[model samples]
Target: MVYPKTGSLIVRDGREMTYTHIQANQTPSRSVCFFFPGASYSFDRPYLYYSTMLFLSKQIDLVHVNAAYGKDIPDFETSSFAKRSAWISEDVKTVVFQVLDQQEYEHVFFLGKSLGTVPIACSLLKEPRFSRSSAILLTPLLREELVVADLLALEQNVFLVSGTADPHYHQPTLERIITSKPNIHRYLPQNAKHSLDIGLQVDLSLQVLQSIMDELGCFLDKSLDI
Candidate 1:
């Protein structure tokens, strides 16, 4: 099912940057979650918005970020991952901060899938004012200098979610990552593959949603109070 998406306008330096959002109508939520897709344009379900809404429900507000919205799609592949990462950090993250900063949202959760994970993590770590934030990662990208380790230190409230069946995430290494991270909560679905397709099983979509809800219940509960 498609989410009830609404666009919020952000005007800064005479340039407009608007992020698309789909709010939960059931409960008034203080926390707003920014859900990022994987490598390609994941405007479709099972990745960015649908999974969030299906799993998160009215627990918190959902913001589906389109990393490729205004960019030149042709040059994306040729551009070095580092440069692309920089674009995300400088251009994309800046827009995110500006949009959220312009208005007041209770608590903020920066959630990402695959390639989209590090940018948000790095963005939050670099910015001091973004203390009121949390991050939930699915099929986390391993061994990026920017986002590797030290995630719990970035914010007081940080949550990391992943799948064991996911090819990208190292299940054994995940244990090590979790050991050091007391704040981060990791959930691994049995036989899950990647984001959206966490595992080779029946009703993978539902399991993915439930997994997210399990780790992020704290924020979801806060939404109830909001």
Candidate 2:
């Protein structure tokens, strides 16, 4: 289950950005998952760590996109939120193209958390080549109506995981949106927060996380027909 991590430095918009690539150990890899972490979260964070392991277990390659605001790239701490998001989107697109150029993956899955979903959604809209790629969105920010609209317009398969108590999004409104779009598979665990932690009790939180991962596994199996 140990996957080798390969690091690469790519320049985008005249700035150096670092990205990590992990190849699955399974022979003849069938798919690749592009991970976009939240604004403040890194690949090492619990949610991403566990999710990445799940995908790796399914024999999927991973490309973890690291943005400028994270500790790995702290030079853009003072940049405006809008500018930072734009830069991250470009960086994500750069890495995506690099991976596509190197391999002919049968299926590409975009995994995004919080603000990370913005870039993935935007990239899919701008690039027709990636239109058929599936997406797994974690705690998408409903505040960005444009992002939500873009996600809705995608004809490709999509799986969304959110918490009922996530402060960043109104549960009622989100539920309504998802209700109208029956094709988008969604999981909203009761009382779970943005991080998908349901309670302070260690056991309870672990249970909630396990349940979410189980749902994600099932969804992936059916979507990719693994």
Candidate 3:
């Protein structure tokens, strides 16, 4: 009985932000996962798409933030990194608060990839209301000092994934977080890029994807005590 409902809201100077809410229509939703895609990645991309399915399978509802910033908002392309991050945070918060106001969810999970992780690290994860929420940061901008600092400050459980080949992957930074923050679990895939795909190795890339999903499932099970 799981189904999806799509809706849109105006945010950040009249820009449109569309989001899809998915859950079992007949079942009461106690948990929800908010998906924040990368600048060039959409919800239909392999990682986000499969993750959406995985959450639904576990009976955790989902909200896909279809914020097409680079394309829909011309200002996004010209804005500085700080400005862009703030814009993203505003858009995400607007959609998330609206959804939460409509219904109460006991558990809140934020999953972000690359550019999307900025808001998760800079805003959502820092907010008092979400201090108890968990986070899944896929290929986060490890090179960014601010993002890494925020991530290190987290107290709730977090699942972090990165690839050795990804330009954003910083060894020293990751080591620091891992050593200091025992609550954050990490997965490092060798020779994988930002997309978590092995360059031109289709089969191996698929296997990597499978492994990530498996680890994510285990994380959810353990975190939820299910």
Best model number under TM-score: 3
- Winner of 1 and 3 under lDDT: 3
User: What's every prediction's RMSD, in angstroms?
Assistant: 4.4, 2.6, 1.3
- Reference-based lDDT, each prediction: 0.61, 0.77, 0.89
In candidate 1, what are the lDDT values of residues 1-226, reduced to their tens digit? 3245555444323344456766675544565777777776375755554557543565566777665523545455577766666656665676577557655677777777777776777665567766656666767766554456545445455556666666666655566667776656667666666754544455766866766665566545543354
> In model 2, which regions exceed 4 Å deviation?
1-5, 26-28, 70-84
> Which residue runs of candidate 1 sit more than 4 Å off their true CA positions?
1-18, 23-29, 41-43, 54-59, 69-75, 150-153, 196-200, 203-205, 222-226
Checking candidate 1 for backbone clashes, the offending pairs are 165-192, 166-193, 192-198, 192-199, 193-198, 193-199
Clashing residue pairs in candidate 3 are none
Instruction: Report the CA-based lDDT of candidate 3 relative to the real structure.
Output: 0.89
Ranking by TM-score: 3, 2, 1
- The order of the candidates by lDDT, greatest first, is 3, 2, 1
* Model 3: per-residue Cα lDDT over 1-226, one tens digit each: 6888898999978778899889855665799999999989888899998998889889999998887766656778888777888888998999999999987899999999899888998899888999789889999999887787788888888999999999999999988987899999999999999999999999999999999999999999887783
- List TM-scores for all candidates, in order: 0.73, 0.87, 0.96
